[model samples]
Target: MHALREVGVEVPEHTLTAVTGPSGSGKSTFLQCAAGLDRPTAGVVRLGGRVISGMKERGLSRLRRTHIGFVFQSFNLLPALTVQQNVLLPLRLDGRPRDPARARELLARVGLEGREGARPGRLSGGQQQRVAIARALITEPDVVFADEPTGSLDQETGAGIMDLLREAVDRQGATVVLVTHDPSVTARADRVLRLAHGRLVQDSWAGTGTVAAGGVPRDAAAVAGGGPVR
Candidate 1:
C-alpha cells in the first residue's frame, strides 16, 4: 500500500513550514521521507540541493548526522543520559569535538540551564521536551524536521516548543519542517501546507494569501478563513 502519492512540496531556506492533516493522512510518512529516515517508493528527496533518495543508507546516515535534526512526539531522550549528555549526543555522534560550553548555552536558551545535571527521568514533560529541542539544535543542523513535536505537551508547553522552533529559524537560520494536526500550531508557520489522502491540498503563506498551483500567492488569507496567523 502507498502511504503517500503524488506529493511534491518545496520549503524555502530558513523558513518554518508546517504540514497538517487529519490522522492517517500520511503526514508522518511525508516527514520521514523528506528527512531521509525512510525511502520513498517514487520521486526524489532533496536536501540542500542534493538528492538524498538515491543515497545509500550509510550516506544518508552521515547526511542526517551532519545536516538534519529531528524532534518527535516522544521527546526520545535517553533516560540513562543526563540532560547535558543528551544534548551533546549529536555532536559526539558526528565525531566532532565536544563543546560543553555550547551544550550549556543551548540548555540556557531552552530555559533549562540549571537542570543540565538532571536525568530525563527526573524532569517534567516540558523540560524533557526542551532538552530535546536543545539536542536537535546542538549540531546547528541545516534543517530540522519535527514530527508532532508538541503532541504530548500541555497547551502552554506546546506553545513554548513552537516558540523555540521559530527561534531556530529566526536566530539560527535553520529551516524547520513541522508535522502537526493543530490549527493553532499551523498558525505559527511561515507557510502552511495541507495534505489529504496523501495529496497536497492547500498551500499558503501565513498572514499573506493562498498559494496557487504553481506556488503563486492569491488574495486569500494565510489560512482558509483569515484566522490569526499568530
Candidate 2:
C-alpha cells in the first residue's frame, strides 16, 4: 500500500510529537516507516543519523531491537507470558542478559508492580497498555513509536496512557513519535504535525509560534476550532 508520499519531517530528540490526520491519511504508515517497521518504496529512512531504508532484514531487525521501541493500540503482549516476562522479552531477544530488577522497576513505574505474575489476559485494557509501555522501554530505546496507543481505551484510560508517555519523555529522555486523531492527544505533544492525503500539511512547535509549510499555530483554540486538518 502506498500510504505516504513526499513526506519529510524531523523528530527532535527527547520530545513528544504527534501526527494527526483523518483515517487512512497515512498516519500509521508514516510511523511504520520512521520506526523501520516498514521500508518506504522510495526515499530513505534515517534513525539517529543512520539510513535504515536500504538495510537487510537481519540488520534492520537488530537495529529495531536495539534502538526502536513500539507501543501499539492492540497492546501486543504475548498472551501466555507473565507481565514481567513480556517486558523483558525485548532485551532477551537482543541477546542481552535479563535484568529482573530493571524489569520490576519499570513495571512499578507503570503501576503494575504486584501484577508482574499476571498474564495479559488477566489484566484490564489500561493495565495491558501499561505493560506494553514498560516493554517498549525495556531497552532504553532511542525512540518510541506509539501508533494510536490509546485508540482502544476509554477517555480516562487514554489520558492515563498519555501521561505515561509524557513521563517517558520527561524522565527517561526518550523520543516519541505518536500517531493519533484525537485533538486532546495532539495537544499534549511538544510538537504537532498534520498529515492529509498522504502528505504533511503542517508542522508546528508548541509555544514557539513557529509554523512550517501548511502548518497551523500550536494553540489550543486553533486546534479545537480547526479540528482534523485533513
Candidate 3:
C-alpha cells in the first residue's frame, strides 16, 4: 500500500510484537502484513515457521483460516446474520464444522452469554464488538491479530474485551497480537513494540513467563529456555 511504504512499515519477526506510534506511524500497515492481508515490499511473512508470503491467494486464505484470527475496530458483523452465525462464519468458511457449545463458551467468556441469537444491529456497540471477539476466537487459531480492537468502545466495555483477550491468551494458549493508540489496552500486553515510519523502534518484552510461545516482541529475543520476555 502507498501508505504502508510511505511510512516504512515492515513485517515483524517477534513472537509478540506491538506496533505503535503517531497517526501516520504505520501501525495499520504493520498489522495488515502480520495478518497476511498485505504483503511486504521485500521480506518474508511467516506464521508458525511457515512462509505465508510465498503462498497463493487461496493458500494464504487457508493459512489464515487455520492459523490466524483477526478482530477489527468496526465489529465487522453481517447485519443479516445472527450472533451465532457471524461467529461461526469463519470456521464454516474453512469447511470446519461449528460447535454450538464452544461458540457459546467463547461468547460467554467475552460477556455476551445469552445474546447469541440477536442480530448485530440489535446489540450495543460493545456487545457487537464482543460478538466480533467471539468470532475471532472461534477457530482457536495459533495467532490472534486485533487491529484497534477497542478503538470504539467505552472504557468499561473496552476493559471487558481486553479481559476476554487476556483470557484467551492464558486459557487458550493462543498467541495474541494487537494494535492500538491506547495505552490502557497495552497494559495487559506481554510486550510492546513501537513503530515509526514502519520500522520497529522500541520493544518491551515482559519476560518469558509474561506470555507463552510465539508471543515475542520485536527487538527482544527469546529468553533462554523461554523464561520471560522482559
Where is model 1 more than 4 Å wrong at Cα?
211-215, 218-230
Best by TM-score: 1
Worst 10-residue lDDT window, candidate 2: 221-230
1-230: candidate 2 lDDT, tens digit per residue: 45786776666688999989899888988888888877777776778889888899999999989888999778789998999999999999999999989999988877788999999999988889888888998899889998887776678767877887898899989899998878889889998888888877777787885465454454422211111121
For residues 156-194, what per-residue lDDT tens digits would candidate 3 score against the true structure?
878888887777778777788888888898777867767
Error in Å for residue 159 of model 2: 3.8
lDDT of 1 by residue, 23-44 (tens): 8778888888889988876677
Candidate 3 overall lDDT versus native: 0.72
True-structure lDDT of candidate 1: 0.82
Give the Å shift of residue 44 in candidate 3: 1.5
Q: What is the lDDT of residue 143 in candidate 2?
A: 92
Candidate ranking under lDDT, highest first, comes to: 1, 2, 3
Model 1 TM-score?
Answer: 0.87
Candidate 2 wrong stretches, greater than 4 Å: 154-157, 210-230
- Give me the runs in candidate 3 sitting further than 4 Å from their true place: 1-16, 207-219, 222-230
Error of model 1, residue 219, in angstroms: 13
